[model samples]
Target: MYKATYFAAALSLALFQSPAVATADEITILAGDLPPMFNADGSGREAEIISTVMERCGHTVSFEIQPFTRHWKTYASGTGDAVATVPVGMPLGGHQSDVYIQYQNGVSFLTDAGNTYGDLAALAGHSVIAFMGASDILPGLKDAASSFKSYKEVADQIGQSRMIFGKRVDAVVGDGMIFAEYNRQLREQSGDLMFDPNQGVTFQAIFEPSSYGMNFRDAQLAEDFNRCFAEADAEGAIEAINSAWAERYRETLGTQYLGH
Candidate 1:
C-alpha cells in the first residue's frame, strides 16, 4: 500500500511538472475604423507599426474589427488579446503601453468657402460632419461643432468625404492623412461613378494632439511589446513608416503638428 501510494504521488508530480503543451502563438488585436490610424482592414499606420513591432517580438498578431462603441466591450469580455490606439478617458484596467500614436485631429473642407471658417467657434453657423469618436477624442472640436447649424457623426472616413463633395455639409473633421486618402479613393471610385463636381479639400489642424496607447490584457506580454517597441522605435522604424504619409499631408496637417 505504501509503494502504491508513493507511485501515485510521483505520477501526479510528473504530470504537474511536465512540459506544457504549445498552443497556437498569436495575439489578437481589436480596433475600429479610425483611418490613417486604425483601419478595420488592417492597413493603417498604427496597425502596420503594431504588427511589425509585435512580430519582431516573436509573436504573430491578428486584427479583429469592432466599432468604436463595441470594440472595448469585446476587448473587456476577453475576446481580444490587446487593443490598439486606445482613446483617452477610456478605462485602463489592464496593462497598456506608452502613447504609441498621437493624433493631431483637424478640420477638413472641400471648397474654399468651407475654409472661411478658420476656427471651431467660427464653424457655429455652418453644417458640419465629423468622424465618430471625435466627441471623445476631440472634445473641443465636438463642442464647437455642436453649435453648428447641423452636426452629424459618421463611422467611416469615406462618408465624410462623400458628404463634403456632395455639398451635404460645409466641413468635415478628421485626421489629415485620412482625409487625403479618402479624397483620393473617392476620386478613383468616381470614374464614371457620379456627377459630383467638387475639388481642393484640406484639413485644418485646430486641436491639440491626442495620444493613444496600445493596451494589453496580459501584463507580461505588454511588457514584452513595450521592450520590442523601444528597440524598434530607437531605430526610427515607426517614424520611417509614417514620414511619407505625414509628408504627403503636410499642407493639411498644418505647420505645427509635423515635428515628429
Candidate 2:
C-alpha cells in the first residue's frame, strides 16, 4: 500500500514537472536601412520576405531597421533573432540560410550624362554616388568612385538620385535592382523633388552577381529557415515577391541569380 502511494505521488510530480510543447514565437530581424530591401516604412522587399517566409514556417518576424553600421551591433550581440542579407563568410553569427536576394551592383550613368567609362580604371576618374558599405561587398567600387557619396537609408537614396538630376554627380554605383526601384520611385513620386530619373539613363553592370542570406543563432533555426525557403519557393511566394523587382535583376544579373 505504501509503495502504491509513493508511485502515485511520483507520477503526479512527473506530470506537474513535464513542460508543454512550445508555441513558435515571433523573432526580430535586424537589418540595414537599404531601400526596397530593408526599409521600415513598408517599402522594403526583404522585410516582406522575412515576414512572408517566416509566416510560412509558423514563425513571426519583426524588423529593426537602422544604419548599416548599427546592424552589426544588434546582430553580433545575439539580441536580434536573425539578420537579413549577411554576405557569405562574415564572422558575425551562426548558420546562414541560402541566398534570398542576389544582384549585380556596379557603376551606371545616364546615357546623356556624358560620363564615359569602359572599365574599372576609367570609372576611377568620375564622381559617384553609392549606398553605404558598398565597398565591403563590391571590391574596388569605393576606390573607383573618385568622389563618393554614400547614404545609410532608403530616403537617402532619393538624395543620391537627385544628385544625378541636379547634375551633382555624373554616375551612381550600387545594386542594379535597387537602382531601378529608386529610379521608378523618384520619377513617379517626384513632387517637390522634380527629378526625372529616366532622362535616357543606361546603367551597366560592373561587379559579379553576389548572394546573401539570413543568419541565425542556432543551427536548427537556420535549417528550418532554409527549409522554409524551399517550401516558399515551391509555393510561389518567392517568385511573387520578386516579380516587381525581377526586371532589373534579370536584366543585369540574369534569372539564375535572382533568388539563390
lDDT of each: 0.68, 0.63
Which has the greatest lDDT?
Answer: 1
The number of clashing residue pairs in model 1 is 0
lDDT of 1 by residue, 1-260 (tens): 00122123332332222222223478888886655666668777778888888898898988887765456555555567787766543453467687667766667776466256557897888898877656655657646765899988777778778788778888887666777777777877735645373477766677667677776777777787889888998999988877766776665554534453
Candidate 2 residues 145-223, lDDT tens each? 4544432322376676777777777777777666766676777773576555557555666667677777777677677
Could you tell me the TM-score of candidate 1? Answer: 0.78
**Candidate 1 local distance difference test against the native:** 0.68
Runs in model 2 deviating more than 4 A are 1-24, 114-118, 122-125, 142-156, 184-198, 234-236, 247-260
TM-score of each: 0.78, 0.71
* lDDT at position 122, candidate 1: 74
- Backbone collisions counted per model: 0, 0
